[model samples]
Target: MSKLIIPLAIGAALLGAPAIPLPSGAGGGALQARELPAYLQCVPYAREVSGVRIFGDAHTWWSQASSRYERGNRPRVGAVMAFRPHRKMKLGHVAAVSKVIDSRTVLLDHANWSPINGRRGQIERDVKAIDVSPGNDWSEVRVWYAPLQALGKTRWPVHGFIYGDGAPAARPRVVSPPTHVAVTRAPSRQFASAFDAIRGGASPAGYRQAKPLPPQRGYRQAKPLVPQQQESQRKSQGQRTGAQARDPIAQVLARYD
Candidate 1:
């Protein structure tokens, strides 16, 4: 019986080149690449670290947290802003309050916003965002874009803010003392414009007609608001607090009040 001996060889040359051992999951290619940074998405990440108890996408947070947490349209540091759907964001977006610069400007920390390294689901920290709403209501805003390093043009509408158990920054807001003036009309000082007091320090009964007050940054009024919008606000307020629903943001506006 003649037995033929067969030689078995296993080496880097088997793959046509020196086989550089790779991690098990590394995909085979002429150019090996490392895995991208693994970062969390917006909604889940916000919920996880926000200390707020709410669920669903960013758009649903405000309505869901209305009863349990302090919800309002004003931005306070540490609140989660629930963006509304618009031309750009169809599923909506959520960002945590990192800093309140002023009444109409804030810095937000969010994930999956700016595309980095040509990848989605990235994190943007301490990005500047500004309120562009006509009412200065914190409803419409523009967020900073990392690639451009500038504020984006896409206007984003927001449902409002959800406040949790978080401390605010050292931002000092001059919340004009709650005025006994008609609730319909914000205090003259609170709504000062570019014009000044008439001839002297006397403001005409009609501020619009009087010399306007020098315009102050982060200070604006929801003037020229249509009757329909006013009526809608009132009606909506009535629905939220029941008999006391006449004021919806009582808990929220308390800071400013």
Candidate 2:
């Protein structure tokens, strides 16, 4: 739910050849996306480690970087993929390319798409994203989910990849976008108790962590009762005894039947 406000650094955008090269034999691996190690979140990680200067909704990245940075329709390692708006993704999404798994699949690092510890804003590194588009132009794609440990069903839009190595130009031409769009990973609680219910055999955390019961009265460790509680118990017992004394038939039934 954050907006991307990027600085148009003139001399840093990727123009022609990329500065960071792709790994050898990258595209030959499995087609599915994978999850990265644990971390704080995407926004800071993208800005701190990946060196993405832009700040806004992930979808607005293309427009914000269009002026000072270069944009493209391909996927490359260290390049940021700026996604266009789509269903529920009104603002869009951005991810750093970690590896190229053939022309149809690529591994990435991003945040907030996967729920971690009842949180939505945590970071997910080295996750897989597949280009679902049949045109092979890198238009439509499906990203990996962290909590579910699988590829999500949502087909996201792509503006293109924005490499950090591009040379900076003049001041960026600011293209203001609409309101921020929120992205949801799975459903509320990921469709289970804590989203952990379905993932962990449906044993709810609440049930598993329930408080222990009090000891019985005959037990040595039975909790001591307060004066008020003792008084109430005595009054109830006294009433029962008085009723029994008043009825000989009740006493006979108790002694025999």
- List TM-score per model, in order: 0.50, 0.47
The regions of model 2 sitting more than 4 angstroms off are 1-41, 167-257
Give the local distance difference test score of model 1: 0.69
Which pairs, if any, clash in model 1?
193-213, 195-211, 195-212, 195-213, 196-211, 196-212
Over the stretch 1-257, how does candidate 1's per-residue lDDT look in tens digits?
A: 11211111132223212224346545433223222334456887677657787877777777777678877778877789889877767778889988887776788989889998888787788888877776768888878887887877677888878888633323338467765856685557634542344545666564544467786889886578699999999988877768454433332233222
Cα RMSD for candidates in order: 17.1, 27.8
Number of backbone collisions per candidate, in order?
A: 6, 24
Candidate lDDT values, in order: 0.69, 0.65
lDDT (Cα, tens digit) per residue for candidate 2, span 30-65: 222223333343454565555879876576667788
Candidate closest to the true structure, highest lDDT: 1
Our tally of clashes for model 2 stands at 24
Q: Which ten residues in a row have the lowest lDDT in candidate 1?
A: 1-10
